[model samples]
Target: MTVNPGHTFARIAIVTVSDRASGGQYEDLSGPAVEQWLRRAVAQPCEFVRRIVPDGVESVRNALLQLCDKDDIDLVLTTGGTGPAPRDLTVEATHQVLTKELPGFGELMRRVSLEQVPTAILSRQTAGVRGRSLIINLPGKPASIGICLAAVFPAVPYCLELIGARKMAEALPDSGA
Candidate 1:
């Protein structure tokens, strides 16, 4: 698939996989938190496609398919559903859509989160590539979202470049893409 990253901005899809958030019981702080962090981490502008879905393999999976397929988002970042809970199904949904798994993103986020909380192991945050879209599952906590994203954020642009999601020189300020 040819991923069309616009010259003006990179496209991103933020999905919050939580029954509570999707049910309107609570606001989706995690999804917004991810968007906030990305705005600061990425130099280029971004076109964000956001979604709040209930915790279910099908719900999350369908959201992923819609974002990665029709939207052509360069990145799909999900928060929630990565825990050990029976309802946590983000990783499973992510796996359902991924063509290639990138173990290092999950490994590094877990390692980084482990430093702050011992229960980080219970978190199953993971990442992979589907076609040209990179999908990463992250923790639901607002505090941990930034920590986990920060741990893996530096490599995100490079990862996107390597996967042909974005052109190499668009990341380089002097390259004149």
Candidate 2:
């Protein structure tokens, strides 16, 4: 999973799960926001592969598998489909893809979000690891995506390391505090 040698950029997949976006009913703001955040935060070059999938377990699961297995991506950030609505199935899809569930990520995200809005408790956002790829589900709103990513991004490099992703240290600077 280490990015192949000689490559300066980390390969990342940004999956946006929204029926409307997938149907072309609206532009995907959250996915772009995730990419923007990565560009600013990583300090290293990143190859972001973006996907828009309808809100469904099968669609999300398929997209995730393809990104992690075929694309060999190091990280997958999924925005939208994380709420309690009838169509929100990002969590279920993530569970089907990841071998291990990282509950602490969700807990920390909700805790940080709770400070701003009491309804943050309703968010089902979570994170997990599929092979060497670390997948994190984020809220749909662009602003919320920024908030949640900032809260959890510092630990991403270490987590990817534990999952055996190579070349991460050079690509993702931790600036250990």
Candidate 3:
């Protein structure tokens, strides 16, 4: 909690839940997209830790627990495995670890995403609080990552503050990508 105490920098983790990416069938672009978006939007010194886990409830659960409960990460952004596909279990895995389910995050994300594509409703992206960390499930596509973050990240700092994370501000600029 509070980002290692006395440290102004935030330690964030980007977990990519993709079987293909984890198995080296394809490169992971979603995780880096998250890092890039946060770097520009947060405007604070941040240390990012990236993890690639295969799509599954167990893998996602394990990775989230390790980062939120053990790694001292302030924020955990999970990409991939958020769709309605059989293997998209990120939301369920995230639910298992959360102390509070913030459904509004998913609602807002889907609402905004619907403006871009109708299939947005198929995404199960959600957010929650586990310990002092904020975990948010994001769509796997690089473009959708930015879209969802823009809709929800404005509240991330406040949510983190309420959850006893390090006090910080997010300067979210217009994500004109």
Measured against the true structure, the TM-scores of the candidates, in listed sequence, are 0.91, 0.91, 0.94
* lDDT for position 16 in model 2: 93
Off by over 4 Å in 1: 5-8, 167-177
Scored by lDDT, the top model is: 3
lDDT of 2 by residue, 86-106 (tens): 999999999999988899999
Off by over 4 Å in 3: 1-3, 172-177
Weakest ten-residue segment in model 1 by summed lDDT: 168-177
Per-residue error for 12 in candidate 1, Å, reads 0.7
Whole-model lDDT, model 3:
0.90
Residue 74, model 3: lDDT of 86
lDDT of each: 0.85, 0.86, 0.90
**Model 3: colliding residue pairs:** none
Report the C-alpha lDDT of model 3 over 1-177, residue by residue, as the tens digit: 345665567778999999999999999999999988887888667888999999999999999999998888888999999888999999999999999999999999999999999999899989999999999999999999989999898899899889988766777465342
What pairs collide in candidate 2? Answer: 2-166
Over 37-58, each residue of candidate 1 has an lDDT whose tens digit, in order, gives 7766666667888999999999
